[model samples]
Target: MKPDEIVVGVDAAWRRSGALDWGLHEARLRRRPLRAVHVVDESLRSDDFAPIRLDGQVVRPSPIPRNDRRLVDELEEYLAGADPALDLAADLMIGAPGHRLAERSASAGLTVVGRRGIGGFARLLIGSTSESAAVHGDGPVVVVPNGWQPAKHASAPIVVGVDDHDQNDAALEFAFEMAAVHHVPLWLVHAWEVPAPYTWNAPVANGMREQWEQAARQWLDTVAEQWHQKHPDVDLRHELRQSHPVVALLDAADATGTQLIVVGGRRHRLPGLMIGSVARGVLHHATVPIAVVHEHRATEPNPGQ
Candidate 1:
């Protein structure tokens, strides 16, 4: 049986080579096919058509261009240069990139995109496409930093932010899988802080902090033990920190030279909503690749079920 394809968003304006490389790496590790997608927003095109240059000749866009030949050529060239043996496909789609990629994620095992795209301003740290995919994609979405080459940090461990919510199960599972694939260690980090109301009272705050720390440690221990039993080959380690989730994750990632950081993406009923604050913050600030896995997808039955 064919494995689920790994979909990656490709853009000519942004530094997308890194994203493609990361997608290829995952595809090889999971023994899956890689689909490189480039979406053209017709609404942004002048006169409902965008001109293209192919083979040193200007080609006028048709009423409905199914696919860009230039893009397909570029994708094929990249694959040939990167890995000739991998099963790779190129798709040129028309619509909003984020929405299109999210739709593709419905059947995809994983979706990968660059942290920032050309649509947003220079000051924007995270692009709309990356954020939308992470928030709305069906499964795990990995946002790779621009110009980030996976080979540079191949020896680093996979760091995952663990919490009390059930959503963290997906993140932990992905982290462990990645660690196993890369033959590296896995670090599970849980960060906690006393509530603001309790912090107002000094004595109460002290006691509450201690309790919270103990609870966090116990929870981390339980999670670690369970995952260790499941993945005996992974060198799994756990840590509890008294800091903000974003801060703790970033610090742990930096300290460990992490290759990838995994976090849980909370599902929202409403549209146009951002992902969880911690995931958003880390996506904006971290220089490393970040994978946001949705809990609903985690609970879903596997294919052919």
Candidate 2:
């Protein structure tokens, strides 16, 4: 894989989302080959503002409209002026946003999309294209939240969510690699809540609750120890929280000034459902940049099922 090749999906609402700048900044920093895909809806390519139908499907012209060519030219010039090492290219593809991005992402080192669109109420709803990319992209999808400004120094730490599972190592490794590249620390966070295991004879008994919580802590400690041994030189620290994973991660981000949050993606097996919950939580709510490591395949049943 060419680590220098990064792809970003840009839509008509890109200027409003302001994700273009954030994406370009990262690509320039890494001196990677940048690909910007603008998927035009067929309905948008109309002289009379009428949708165009082709092959039983609407077709929108690719690469943005001629009116927007100036912006693209400006971006190209800025990239060349800011970094001579950066090679930039733009593609205007006509297709479904989600499908086009997913298909192209297989060969990209990274893919970036904005969280929301342009408008008052629409800004509150995450963009459907971005949501699809997050859940389906072959490579890591960077969710640039609305109003996110690229840091000048990029010194903030990388935070990763971990649970007792085999794929947790992938998330940890990704987090450390990011930290190493940015010269920042890594915060290994594990949030645990005692399972509300109950019996038909009675409600959940608190008598054994403490025991279960203790066991959970022990599991976190064991995982943390293993990771620490492997990454001895990495500036790493650990946190074990007795709260919901989603809320705990938010609180940790606030307390630690985190710039990126990482989590594991498990597709199949017994533990699948167990880790799926945490991944979903972060995907939906984590405010900072999220790096979801897609590891598990869907064929396996979730653990404890």
Candidate 3:
């Protein structure tokens, strides 16, 4: 699907620093509509209650319902102010927040949620409903950190992690389009390890060491040069080292100010059955946001093309 047709899912809570601006910024770049969603979980309604003993002995203490509609109204107002021309809708649901958000993501091209949501500061530090959405949502999920302001014009570049063992053309193309639309740089990074000789064996296999380094450098050059032809305007950089892909990516994020790290996710149905090593490493340790493109559909574009 084209970026213009993308449905951006916005999980807005009543906060002023909501994800509406962030989501709208993306929509503006892609020329897509935004769906602002507010989930009012019954579980969060109230917990304070009193048992009735004798007749009229004790009155029940009922906690007030969370003002879900107010949050939705506030979100609509924010959306209206953020982008007056784009198509937008606000949905309020009474169910499990995570499940509702995931279901809403079914048709969306991407989902955006605040790193710290309405509940307050503690939620940001720990695992949040947003994090759950990111891990399980069908489409690409963008987790906006606290104090994140949507640029009137998006500036952060699209960065994709390229693995020698995996098919990355799909992700690279995705990043390319995003970068092109946002008018930002595109960085292609490949991180590989140098073979280390086993202890009690040779301290250094001099011949093998030289060959390994040469192969790593050549791989980076070839991939960068090949993508450069298609994305000539994109500012590209390459990093090849003995460290792990996860570590290398985090380091690169700091050095280059990467906004998103697009990587390919495993396509297997069963859990823990077919997770790739590089993806697994990235899932656990990458510092920046991730875009995991799955490989099940034939219509999905190839990254090289």
The runs of at least 3 residues in candidate 3 whose Cα sits more than 4 Å from the true structure, single-residue gaps closed, are 1-18, 45-66, 118-126, 152-154, 195-207, 272-288, 295-305
Candidate 3 has an lDDT of: 0.64
* C-alpha-based local distance difference test score of model 2: 0.70
Clashing pairs in 3: 169-303, 170-303
- Who is ahead in TM-score, 2 or 3? 2
* Total backbone collisions for each predicted model: 0, 11, 2
Q: Kindly list the per-residue Cα lDDT of model 3 for residues 162-209, writing each as its tens digit.
A: 877767776777778778877788777777665444423454655466
Better lDDT candidate (1, 2): 1
| TM-score sort, best first | 1, 2, 3
Instruction: Between candidates 2 and 3, name the one with more favorable lDDT.
Output: 2
lDDT of 1 by residue, 100-170 (tens): 98888878878899988767798887888888887888778899988888988888999999878546777
lDDT string, candidate 2, 150-250, tens digits: 67438889898887655676677778777877778889888776565553324454666678778888887887788778877778888888788888888
* Model 1 lDDT-worst window of ten: 60-69
